[model samples]
Target: MIDQEDLELKCLGLIYTMVQNHLSDKQKEVKAELESNKAMENIYVFKSSTSLVNDMQVGKQGPIATRYAKSNKDISDVVDELQALLSKNSSKEGVTVDG
Candidate 1:
């Protein structure tokens, strides 16, 4: 099994890359400013939307899930990212991921 700390670094790496690639530095600065306060909210920022439709057609109500981050709140950036990816990749809003 992978060390959890290593996994965490990997996750942070990915998240950092995502934020860097998709968001403007101004946005990153804004997000950084908000991070301290948002951390207190304890909201679950849902990520990773697997298409429930195809599975549902066969019979399934999904999480059909994947974990994008364990740190949920300071996630507006991630949410922004997933939205961009979805818009880029989706047809008929086939991929409905939220976080």
Candidate 2:
């Protein structure tokens, strides 16, 4: 003959064990997801950094180099033209003063 109070206590204990097992499984799943996310983040950082370095290396010999060279030449030409104009103006001013 099982007593009512004892039966209730056994049922509560069994429910408690089942809940604990369920919670443990859920905790493991959450931990695994967190680790997976961290690994993915690390991979993304590595790839981005590698790409940046490659781009920098390529810039020295690629289209970026051509662009920079063109810009420098354009600036030099402008500077030369300005100097020529200034010299011509100075010479005209000198002739006016001398005459």
Candidate 3:
């Protein structure tokens, strides 16, 4: 169970990490130029949140209701594409240290 703000933060973290991990400098520059007017931040948030909700992964979070009317398949597709992109390119295993 996650709140909307937490969801958005997760989305931002995922996108930012993926961008840092995958895109080369040239590709990043191209992306900046091509998507200058696009709301990329919101796009990530919307995509992740909608995906979780649609998949029934997000139950009510501590009496909070974070619901949306519409979910975008195109954004979900982008997420899926990103997954494939990461899998195809990523090699190093990551380590996590929890607090």
Report every candidate's CA lDDT: 0.42, 0.38, 0.43
Rank by lDDT (best first): 3, 1, 2
Question: Which residue pairs overlap in candidate 3's backbone?
Answer: none
The runs of at least 3 residues in candidate 3 whose Cα sits more than 4 Å from the true structure, single-residue gaps closed, are 1-70, 91-99
Better of 1 and 2 by lDDT: 1
How far residue 41's Cα lies from its native spot in candidate 1, in Å, is 35
Model 2 weakest 10-residue run by lDDT: 10-19
lDDT of 1 by residue, 38-94 (tens): 552443333432222233234344322232222233355466756765565564557
User: Top model by TM-score, which number?
Assistant: 2
Provide TM-scores for the models: 0.22, 0.29, 0.24
What lDDT, from 0 to 1, does candidate 2 have? Answer: 0.38
lDDT of candidate 2 over 1-99, digit per residue (tens): 235355643211100111121346777686457547843443211100001123324575553422454444444554455455456657877832221
Give residue 60's error in model 3 in angstroms: 20
Count of steric clashes across candidates, in order: 2, 0, 0
Candidate 3 — worst ten consecutive residues by lDDT sum? 12-21
